[model samples]
Target: MSQTTQPLHFARQPHPSPVAPEQRAELLRNPGFGRVFTDHMATIRYTEGKGWHDAKIEPRGPIPMDPAAAVLHYAQEIFEGLKAYRTADGGATLFRPEENARRFQKSAERLAMPILPEALFLEALDQVVSIDRDWIPEGDGSLYLRPFMFANEAFLGVRPSSEYLFIVIASSVGAYFKTQADAVSVWVSENYTRAAPGGTGAAKCGGNYAASLVAQAEASRNGCDQVVFLDAVERRWIEELGGMNVFFLFEDGSMTTPPLGGTILPGITRASVLALAKDKGITVREEPYSLDQWRADAASGRLREAFACGTAAVLTPIGTVKGRDGEFTIGNGRSGARTEELRNTLVDIQRGRAADPHSWVHKVF
Candidate 1:
């Protein structure tokens, strides 16, 4: 699939009455991530007979769909998350968005849906971000972009629907971590599993996150910020968090994380971190690190730090890991040096402060 752009005409409509500047400023003061939205969104449609067509950039508002939509009943859906950065030179750029497009196609195939062409997906995202460039905030803020597709055909059968809709929305978001980037407490989910061996665990489908909400709630009740799901079969190996991937840095200058065992999301951030680690001459291992090993290593002073990475939180240090039995503290209960180094390096590259050695940044304008 070529990355060249095709001139797809968009039907535009300015908001009849956009939020006043003062009101918008007040909201942007904190933004609080994903709570506030821009005034416009991009949309497109696809059908069995007609491929992806009727692409348009329209006003930001509610969508009109039938009550018996396939998404509501059968839950056939997929989505992707990426950010648009406001460069120091006032240029707008996207972070590895082509990777997101490829992942979205994989997600569609897993959900038994039609794959959106790479060119079409990238064009939609570019148009949306460019139109809403004013909404991109300053000082570590971003224009959070969500591109999702759902089965829209009004059908009741258990088969895949013939009609589908893909839409991209932009939201002005502040830091995902409200305060300082402190370590978050994580809980071990004993009663539930996020995915099975031969399940849709790796796909970025809505159902996988939906299934994790309860476990997340359980973690919250236990005074934790996120839930760590164990392997479905053994229930001993660490898998991933509710929405991010996990990593561990050892005292011997080596690091490791759980391997992609067909039950974990292949996060773009995770892949980038691995590449960065290799470039930095750090020995990295992708293997199954179990809970017992985590506790043993922490006690033995071999495990130095633990953190989770994703598009939303960029990077967050893990302070404590608590389960039914007890809790384990890591790195003096704070973000460690190695963790901060990696986080800062990645963020610097992303926010245009440092050179993007990986050529991961894509200029949107």
Candidate 2:
């Protein structure tokens, strides 16, 4: 696939009936995740031979689709999530949006979907954010951006679609957890598995999330906040949480997370945490840790902390682990010092409070 070097110019189609400032302020006061959306959305269409075209920022509304659309039958879809933060200088910026664009391309290729050019992806994000800058909430709140692509072709016969639609939308969101110190409990899903050796585990697609819904429900029923899945084959080695990646902090000032082979989603937040930890002279390992070892370490005071990482749930402490084998607490069932430090460091860099040494934050305004 050939990549476009030049930036794609997006057409502007302002929304006629946008939310009033008063109403928008009211909604932004407590904008939960994925609940309230901005007035407009950015879109681009792609044909097999024509490449990507008809790029515009239009109003937010329901999309017309055929009953037998390719996405309905085969589910050829991919999406990426990131946030636009309100900086201290009274401006808006995005955290590692290019990384999301690259991941979106990898997901598209895995699903046999046309890779939306990286330049177009970034342009779409900037266009949406620039128009909906007011939707970005103040303080700890942010504007979450969701970029997605799906097969829109009407006819489908168990093959890839010839046409696709790429769209970007913005939403005002609060923190995933109510407070930074509120740790969550996890339930091990022995009956369900998230991904296999040659599956779409690594792809940020809707199907992967759809498959984990049942396990998540099980976790809720078990009185836990999230569900953890182990390897599909042995069911002993820990893979990841329902949607987030897991990390373990040892008592010896070291950390370990399951290596990314083909069954784990390479998260941007996870990578940032690993890099930050390494920069602080903390020993980080990407080796597989089994559930048995996790339990034993927790019981023997070998494991100091455990947490989950993702775009939505930035860095949440895992206080308890429950399964049919029994339940156990990790490090006195509280957020550890290292976990809090890493989370604060990352959040500071994101909100423009700390120096961006790696140039991860992209200023849009």
| Alpha-carbon RMSD to native, per candidate | 2.0, 1.3
RMSD of 2: 1.3
- TM-score: which candidate is best? 2
Q: How high is each candidate's TM-score? A: 0.96, 0.98
Model 1: residues >4 Å from true position, as ranges? 1-7, 178-181
Worst 10 residues of 2 by lDDT: 1-10
Supply the TM-score for candidate 1.
0.96
Instruction: Give per-residue lDDT, candidate 2, residue 69.
Output: 83
Clashes of 1: 0
Write down the worst ten-residue block by lDDT for model 1: 1-10
Report how far off residue 123 is in candidate 1 (Å).
Answer: 0.9
**Candidate 1's residue-wise lDDT over 47-131, tens digit each?**
7866777888888889999999999999999999999999999989898999999999999988889888888888899989887
As a whole number from 0 to 100, the lDDT of residue 264 in candidate 2 is: 95
| CA lDDT for candidate 2 | 0.92
lDDT of 2 by residue, 107-177 (tens): 99999998888778988999999998999999989999999999999995988899899999999999776
Model 2: pairs clashing at backbone N, Cα or C within 3 Å: none
